[model samples]
Target chain A: MIELAGVTKSFGANRVLAGVDLSVGRGRSLVVIGGSGTGKSVLLKCILGLEAPDAGRITVDGRDAATGDREAFLACFGMLFQGGALFDSLPVWQNVSFRLLRGALKRPRAEAREIAIEKLRRVGLSPDVADKVPAELSGGMQKRVGLARAIAADPQIIFFDEPTTGLDPIMSGVINDLIREIVSEMGATALTITHDMTSVRAIADEVAMLHGGVIRWTGPVAALDASGDPYVDQFIHGRAEGPIAALR
Target chain B: MRLPLSLLAALGAAVLSGLAAVGRVTLFALATFRHMLSPPFYGREFLVALGNVGWLSLPVVGLTAFFTGGALALQIYAGGARFDAQAVVPQIVALGMVRELGPVLVGLMIAARVTSSIAAEIATMKVTEQIDALVTLSTHPMKYLTVPRVLAGIVAVPLLVGLGDIIGIFGGFTVGVQSLGFNPSVYIRNTWDFLEPLDVISSLVKGLAFGFIATLMGCYAGMRSGRGAQGVGRATKASVEGASVLILAANFLLTGVFFSL
Candidate 1:
């Protein structure tokens, strides 16, 4: 479980996140829907303590995220960045087993490689792709490798930032399905940020719309259609003329 | 009056920003040292950096030293002839190359080569979010990336400087014997006898300082880079610029410290 209370962050004169209070229950999949530059990524970064919020607190399973052993705290969660963020210098297997190759979770090299191959398989990749660098893989394949990495450690929680941003519709669907399956199978608490409606329908157990640095609406996925909030309505319908302004 | 005030204001702002950059770099360097002294040492990364900053740099350092040494010999011979001091070629060349040029040239070469490369690579990593990924994976970026490269520069560049000094002396010897019509045995003996331990020590010390400056500037510029391809370009440019200027400045300060004291 994750909790954020009265979280606010500002950059220069621009307030990216203003008084954000959000939480995700244990083992639930919460997908945040926001337009570009809506501070969705900032919210995730704040939760992970990657970016410090100006005010308020964030906690995971009751411990303040800002305090405690950083390495131990971070060990509980895995993140798949918007870009794959795979180490270009490393082979795909090394990237996937990065956590296992060092730090407190380190395993022997042979064992780490075996786990990387297994996780790659879980994400629909074969063993042959293991030795190749991330640059040699296609975009979709790279995304798959990233997913494999996120789940490789079997983390208690996983954060997906724009998991299907640049993929085609079919590939996006495949990624969404893979995410849904992995989160369910692992029983991991999942938090994802995306603007894709198709991805939301496919992956989200609960949906929250972010606009004007605040959560406009939040409910079960079934209620997304009839949320009755103007901002959510405008966003889900993709209407040019609505309460939500088009030009960011 | 307004024009002068505006100029003053611009100069003040430049000074302030420069001071801020210096402060940031100082803090970053201190943090890198802290990480270097701590545990979970990344020996593998350090070895890779050693190869990059040391072995891969041999050809360029050697070639630059060789050509510079040859040119210096010719210049000394030509200039000394006017004063009837052409016989002083071996002594001057030995002192000049060992005491100054060897370390300075190698430092500049590393600034141009390794500094630019490290900045570009790390800046690209920052842009692509690999740095954030490293953080999320529970790895300290400073521990994983900066310490190894900085340590390598500290460990390797001095040795390179020593090798460059030797190669440069040999180059001067070659020119002195074959080109300048000087006796080979006399040139060799003169070059050897003219050098002192202080000159060698000073050269190695300059190498140590210059190496630290080059790699530190590269890592500093890179970690502070902005986003996108333009950011990467700027980081690479700033790294080489910073490394070159700092190496030269360090060379001057170090020279005064060694020779003056």
Candidate 2:
């Protein structure tokens, strides 16, 4: 399980997160929904230790995450970035097996390549794509490659940031299904941030709405439609007139 | 009156911000050095960096050094002829190549090509959230990204400088014997006689320092770049400007120190 309490972050005079609290159980999917600039990404970054919260207590599996040994903590997690973030200079196989090529996880080159090919297969990519550079791949293919890399280590926890942002509807659905299958089959605790309702419906077991730097509503995915919170209602229906000022 | 006041305020603010940025960069660099000395080094990343910063740079470095040496030979021969001192062409060319031209020219070339490329590549990666991905994967950006490049710069630049020195001297020799009515044997002997260990060492040291500054500035600007196309452009420009200026300044100081004794 992952838990965050009283997390706050500010950049100069602008407060991006204001004492936000959240929790996710193991082997479950929690999808965070929010408008742009609403600190959803900030929250995820804080959890990943990419951004340090000014005032917060973050616990992972009943231990304090902030003060824990970083490498050990990070070794348990995998992440899929919004842009796929494949290294342009590296071939697909090298990118997929990057972590396994160094440090304590080091493996023989042939072994690492084999593992990369297997993970690629899991993500529905051909082994022939292994030698190609990231720039040679299409957007959907890159995302699949990113997914392959994320699950390469078979991590116990996974985070996905805006996973369906640039893909077409069909591709988005494919990615959403893949994410759902991986989380359930691998029994990994999954936390994802996205504005795509289709992805939310497809991947999430529980949905949380972030507004004004706090979770305005959170419940099972089925209850999201009848959560009765004005902010959730306004956001879900994509209505123009609501408490969330469209201009702001 | 309002414009002048605002301008003054802006200038003051800019100075303060610049100082702060420098301090932060210095701290980050120190942290990287600390990490580098510790165990669990990334061998694969280091090899990639060597390939990028060293081997691939040879063509450009070689071309620059060769041409600069040839040009220096012609100019020196012309100037020496005015005083019937054309025989000193080899000595002067060798000294110029080893002591000043070789390191400075190589540094400038790297600043132009390598620095801009690194900054732009990293800045694009930053804008596209690739650096963020590295962090999410449990990799420290400083260790995974900056350390290898900085180490490569330190290692590669000296080799480049040594290569530059040899190529430059050969260039000078070629021009001296073929075009300047000088004997090939005499020019080579003169060049050998004038060249000293101190000059070679100074050039190598300067190369190392220049390389470090150039790559450091590139990585620094790139990592701190803002999020957009315009921000990436600004980072690229700032990286080249910073690396070039620092290289020149460092070259002057190193020269002063080397020659003072």
Candidate 3:
């Protein structure tokens, strides 16, 4: 389980995340939904230790995020960055097996390559695509490659950051299905942030809404529509005139 | 009154920002040194850096050395002739190339090529969140990225300077014997006799110092680069500028220390 309590972050005069309290139980998928600039990305970054919250405590499985060996802690989690963030210099197989090729999780080169190709196959990529670089692939293909890398280590925790943001609707559905399947099969703790309603329906067991730097509403997917919160209703139904006003 | 006050404020801001940048770079250099000495070293990345910064740089360094040597020989001959002192041409050219021009010119060239490239590549990685990805992969950016390149510069550049010195003197010798109607044996003997061991040592030392400054500036600017294409452009420009200027300044100080005594 991952828990964040009273997490607040600010940049200069702009407060992005203000005392956000949220939790996801073990092996559950939580999709955080929000409009642009509402601190969804910042919240993920804070939990990932990429960005430190000014005032908060985050714990993973009962220990503080800041304690213990950093590398050992990181090894337990896998993340798919929003932009795919694949190393342009490396080919697809190398990118997928990056961690396994070195460090404590180091495996034999041949074994690592085989595993990478296997993971690639799991994400619907052919073995022939293994040698091609990230630049050679299309955006959707790159996202799939990113997904392959995230699951490459067979991590206990997986983070999907805007996984379906730029894909076509069909590709988006494919990716959404992939995420759902991967989470279910691995029984991994999954945290995702996206505004795609389709993705919310397909990927989430639970939903949390972030608005104005706080969790305005959080409940099960079934309870999202009838939660009786105006902000939640306004956001889910995509209504502009309600309490959660869209910025002009 | 208003114009002068605004100008004063602008000057003050520039000075403050400049100092801040210097402070940050100094701290970065210290951290790079620390990481380079520590374990969990990435051997493959180190080898790649050596090939990229050292071996690949040879052709450009050789060409530059060859042309500079020839020019130096011609210039010294022309100037020396005014006082019937043209015999000193070989000695002057040897000393000049070995002690100063070769290492300094090579350093600036690296600043122009290697430094800008490192900054641009790293800044692009940062913009793409690749650096953050490395962090998530449990790799320190300084260890995985900065240390290998900086260490390569420290090791490869001295060898390059030594090679450049030799090639440049050969250029001088070719021009001295073939173009200037000088005796080959006498010119060669003069160059051989006039150069002290200290001169060669000083050149290599300068090479190491210049290399460190050049590569360090690149990594520093890159890691701190702002977002967007404009940010990347600024980082590249700043890296080259910082590396070139610092290399020149260090060269002057090194010359003073090596030869003054």
Candidate 4:
């Protein structure tokens, strides 16, 4: 399980996460939904220890997340960034197998490549694409490659940031299905941050809506529609004129 | 009263910001050095950086040194005629190339070439979130990106400067023998006999300092860059400017320390 209490972060004068408290149970999928610029990414980064919280405690599986050996703690977690941030210089297989090829997880180059190719296949990519660089892939392919990389080491925990952000509806559906299938098969603890309702409905076991740097509502995926909160209601229906003021 | 006060405020603000930028770069350089000494060093990355900064730079450094040396020989010949000291051409050229021009010119070229390239590549990586991806993949961006390049600069640029000094003096020799009415054997001997080991060493040291400054500025500017294409462009420009100014300043300091007498 992962937990955060009073997690706060700010960039210069602009406060992003303000005294936020949230958690995800082990072996469960939690999707944190929020609109643009609502600190969804910041919240996720804080959990990953990528951004230090001004005042907060984050614990994973009953241990302080930031207190342990960073490599060991991080080895258990897999993350897919919003932009499919693959290493531009490396081939697709190298990108997928990066962790395996270096540091404490170092393996033979050929073995790492073989595993990378296997993961690529798991993500619905052919072996032929393994030698190509990330630039050679399309938007959807890049995301899949990123997904393959996330699961390459068989991490026990996975975080997907905007998994279906820029794809077409068909591609989004395909990605959502892949995410769902992978999570189920691996039984990994999953935390996803996205504004996509379809993605939430498809992958989430529970849902948390973040707004104004706090969890506005939390419930099961099925109960999201009838949560009865005005902000939740305003958000789900996509109404412009609502309690949630639009950005200029 | 308002005008003067506002102008003062603006001046103060600029000064404060410049100080802050210096502080940031200093901290960044320290961090890079710290990571370089720690475990899990990236040898492949270091090798690649060396190749890019040292080997690939030979052609341009060689070409620039060659032309500068040729021009200096010509200028020395023309100016020395009035004083009847035209025979000092080889010695002057040797001293000029070995002690000052070789390091400075190579430093500037690195500022233009390597520093700009580092800033652009890293800024683009920052824009694209590749740095963040690196973090996720259990890597320090500094160790992977900055340390290797900076260390390479320290290692490779000295060699480049030494090569540049030799090539530059050779350029003078070529011009002196072919164009000027000078004895080839005496000209070569004058170039060789007049050069001190200290001069060559000082030139290499200047190269090291300039290389460090150029590369550190690039990485610092790039890592701190804002989002988008415009941000990357601005970072690249700032890197080159910072590198050029720092190289020149360092050149002066190194010269003073090396030749105080």
Candidate 5:
């Protein structure tokens, strides 16, 4: 479980997040839908402690996220970045097994490699792809590799940032399905941010619409269609004329 | 008067920002040292950095020292001819190369080669979100990336400077014997006798300082880089510019220190 209360962050004159309050229960997949530059990524970063919130508090399972051994706090979570963020210098297997190859979670080299291959396989990748670097992979394959890495350690919570951004519709569906399956199977709390309606329908157990640096609407995914909030209706419908300006 | 006031205000802002940057760099350097001394030491990363900063730098450092040594010898010989002091070429060449050129040239070459590469690589990593990913995976980016490269620079550049000093002296010897018509044994003897142990120590000390400054600037510029390709380019450029100027300034201060001490 995660909770954020009155979280506010500003970059100079630009206030990206202001008075944001959000929470996600354990083992639930919450997809935050918002237009581009809506501070969705910033919200995620604040939760992960990657970016400090100017004013507010965040807690995970009741412990203050700001005051703990950072490594220990981070150990319970995994993240798949928007760009895959695989280490360019490392092979695919090493990227997937990165957490296992170092730190307190370290495994023997051979065992780590085996686990990487297994995770890669679970993400619909072949063992042959393990030795190749991320650059060698196609965009969809790279996304799959990123997903494999996020779930490799069997983290209790996973954050997916734009998980299907650059992929084709079919690949997006595949990734959405994979994410849905993984979250369900691992019973992990999942927080994802995306504007993709297709992905939302496929993966979200609950939907939260973020706009103007606050949660405007939130309900079960089934209730998304009739949420009755103008922002949520405009966003889910992808209307050019709506509360969210088409031209920024 | 209003225009002059505006100009003064602008200058004042620049000075303040410059001071702020220096403060940030000082803190970054302290953190790097702290992480370096503490463990979960990354031996493999450190070893790879040693290879990159040390072994791979041999050719450029060698060539720069060799050519500069020869040029210094020629200039010294020609200058010495004015006062019928051509015989002093070996001693002067030895002093100039060992006391100044060897470490400075090698340091500059490293700034261009190793510093730029480190900055570009780290900046690209930051831009790509790999740095953020490192944090999510519970690896301290400073420990994983910065400490290894800085340690390598500190450990390796002194050796490169020492090698450059030797090759530079040999280059002078070759030119003196073959082209300047000096006896090889006499040239070697003069170079050896003219050099004090203090000169060698100062040269190595300069190497250590230059090395630390160059690599630290790279890591600092990189870790603070903004997003996208332009950010990477800016970081690379800033790293080289900062490293070069600092190395030169450090060389001057270090020279004064050595002489005074």
Candidate 6:
């Protein structure tokens, strides 16, 4: 379980997160939806301890997450970035088993490589792709590689940041299904931040809408369509006639 | 009155912000150093960094030292002809290469090439969210990225500087024998006699310090890069400029410290 209470963050004069509170239960998928620059990413970063909250507490698994041995706290979670940020210099297998190949978890190079390849296979990538660098893979393949790496250590919690941002609809659907399957099979707490309705529908057990640095609505996935909040309605229907103004 | 008040306010804010930023960055550096000393040392990453910072850098370092040494010899010989002090050519070349020219030139070359490369690569990664990916994977960006590269720079630069000094002295020797009509044996002897151990040691020390500054500034600028294409470009530019300036400043301070004693 994860809980964030009254978290606030500011960059210079612009306050990105303002007294935001949220919680996600274990073995549940919570998706945060918001338009660009709405602090959805900042909320995730705050929970991950990448960005320190100015005012409040974040607890992961009932432990204070904001201050402590951050490495140990982070070890319990995995993240899949929007851009599928695989290390360009390393081959797919090395990238996947990066954590396992290091200290405390150190295995022989061959054993680490074998584990990496197994994870890749789980993500629908072939053994042939294991030796290839990230630059050689297509966008969809890279996202799979990123996903494989995320699940390599069998983390208790997983964070997905815009898992379908740049992919085609088919690829997005594939990724969304993969995320759902992984979350269900592992029974891991999943938190995803994205604007894509399809992704939310496919992966979220619960949905939260972020606006003005605070969650405007939180309910089961089914309630998103009928939430009746003007902002939620405006955002979900993609209508220009509502309170949300077009950038033009 | 409005302009003056605004200016004062801006100045005050700038000072405070600068101090805050420095404090934050210092904390980040300390954390990185601590992680480096702790377990989970990424040997593969370290090896890759060594290859990047050491082996790959040799060609540029060698070429720069060689050309600079040859040029220095030519210039010294030309200047010495007027005073009929041509016998000082070998000694001056050796002193220049070991004491100042080799380290400074190699440092500048690295600042130009390696610093910009690291900055641009990391800034692009930042813009693309790669650093965040590392953070999310339970990897400390400081440990995974900055530590290996910074540690490699510390280990590799001194070796490169020593190599540069050798190449540079040889360059001067080549010019002295082939171009200046000097006895090769006598020139080598004079060069050896003029160089003190202190000069070589100073060069190595300067190299290590400059290398640390170059890579640290690069990583700092890259990690702090904002989102988008323009942000990455700005970060790259800032990194190169910052690294170059820091290297020169550090070189001066290191030289002063070494000679002051």
DockQ of each: 0.95, 0.74, 0.89, 0.77, 0.93, 0.64
lDDT of 4 by residue, B141-194 (tens): 999999999999999888989898989998999999999988999998888899
Instruction: Summarize candidate 1's per-residue lDDT along A1-248 as a digit string, tens digits.
Output: 79988999999999999988888999999999989999999999999988999998999999999999999999999999999999999999999999999999999999999999999999999999999999999999999999999998999999999999899989998999999999999999999999999989988999998888888788999999999998898899899888888998
Could you give candidate 3's per-residue lDDT for residues B121-166 as a string of tens digits? 9999999999999999888999988998899899888888999999
| Structure candidate 1, residue pairs in collision | none
RMSD of 1: 0.9
Residue-level error in angstroms, candidate 5, position B161: 0.5
Instruction: List the candidate numbers ranked by lDDT, top first.
Output: 5, 1, 3, 4, 2, 6
Report, for all candidates in order, the number of backbone clashes. 0, 0, 0, 0, 0, 0
| TM-score of every prediction relative to native | 0.99, 0.96, 0.97, 0.97, 0.98, 0.92
lDDT of 5 by residue, A1-248 (tens): 79989999999999989888889999999999999998999999999999999999999999999998998899999898898999999999999999999998999999999999999999999999999999999999999999999998999999999999999999998999999999999999999999999999998999998888888988999999989898888888989987788986
Kindly state the number of residue pairs that clash in model 1: 0
C-alpha lDDT of candidate 1 relative to the true structure: 0.94
Q: DockQ winner among the candidates? A: 1
Cα deviation of B163, candidate 4, in Å: 1.1
Candidate 3 ranges beyond 4 A from true positions: B1-6
Residue B210 miss distance in model 5 (angstroms): 0.6
**Candidate 5 regions off by >4 Å?**
none
DockQ, candidate 2, comes to 0.74
* Residue A192 local lDDT, model 3: 97
Against the true structure, candidate 1 reaches a TM-score of 0.99
lDDT values for all models: 0.94, 0.90, 0.93, 0.92, 0.94, 0.87
Clashing pairs in 6: none
Model 6 accuracy (lDDT, Cα): 0.87
Standalone chain B TM-score for every prediction = 0.99, 0.95, 0.97, 0.98, 0.98, 0.92
Full ranking by DockQ: 1, 5, 3, 4, 2, 6
